[model samples]
Target: MGNMSKELLREYIKEQNFTNANDILNGLKEMFRDVLQEALEAEMDEALGYRKYDGIEKTNNNSRNGYSKKTVKTELGPVQVNIPRDRNGEFEPRIVPKYQ
Candidate 1:
């Protein structure tokens, strides 16, 4: 997704899609949410010491439990994120935080 956003923006400009500032703002908000979600997933991988669905043998006892829906307030708006969980319940996400 490196240049995907730029390509989309080019298409939008070619079609004259954005009529006002709100449209651009909304697009940026959506992009921000996507980036935040990706970061959260990466953080989970680091905390768990494994990527999602990896077939490698478990090095430690802790493992990925699942995900929990979490709505977080951002500068753009409220974005719902899938917070990852560990079996030991010791994974504290620094991106969104547990109590945020």
Candidate 2:
């Protein structure tokens, strides 16, 4: 029904000693990291004004054009993402690291 807050979830797990919760969280974290990485890479590719997809680089299939390497700044530090680009000479790489 309603979204469970992080604090609530933490407290519930702590009280129950539910190790499963940690596993689930770890799994989710992995999934999120992968998805986030792909998204950020795509964005970075676009920002770099990429025009085509190169085997050397990770480019989104949705991108019709190519892409270029970009350096993105993040809270953790500098992250490089491959932004997507359009065939119409449009590409904007993002300034974020590609998550695992």
Candidate 3:
């Protein structure tokens, strides 16, 4: 997980204007889903040895193919997340396993 600055958190909460318990829970779920998605993207970048859209330092031919939608069951409920895929089919996500 990454550190979210207080200013950014405050700004996000203000934008949300959470007024009830259910609203707060829903907001948390959204945050969790977003963080998980970002982590998956970062993992792909690391595995492929270059960030997406940057062909400067790319040494291999493997590249980003597309995304596969997977429903992750969390304590909050089921959240739909897009798992990044590589062209060579060697990108196995560790955050949410392919078989999980």
- Which candidate comes out best when scored by TM-score? 3
Native RMSD of candidate 1 (Å): 3.2
How big is the positional error of residue 63 in model 1, measured in Å on the Cα after superposition?
1.7
Evaluation by lDDT, superior candidate among 2 and 3: 3
lDDT of 2 by residue, 1-100 (tens): 1586989867755665546767766544544555656875556455544633465554444445545555555444454444544555544334342232
> Please, what is the whole-model Cα lDDT of each candidate in the order they appear?
0.85, 0.52, 0.93
Clashes of each: 0, 26, 0
How many backbone collisions does model 1 have? 0
Off by over 4 Å in 2: 1-19, 51-100
Q: Per-residue lDDT tens digits of candidate 1, residues 1-100?
A: 4667987779866665778899888877877888888998899889877888899987789988889999998888888888888999999999898996
Give the RMSD in angstroms, all C-alphas superposed, for model 3: 1.6
In model 2, what lDDT does residue 90 have? 42
Residue pairs clashing in model 3 are: none
Give the candidate order by descending TM-score. 3, 1, 2
Better of 1 and 3 by lDDT: 3
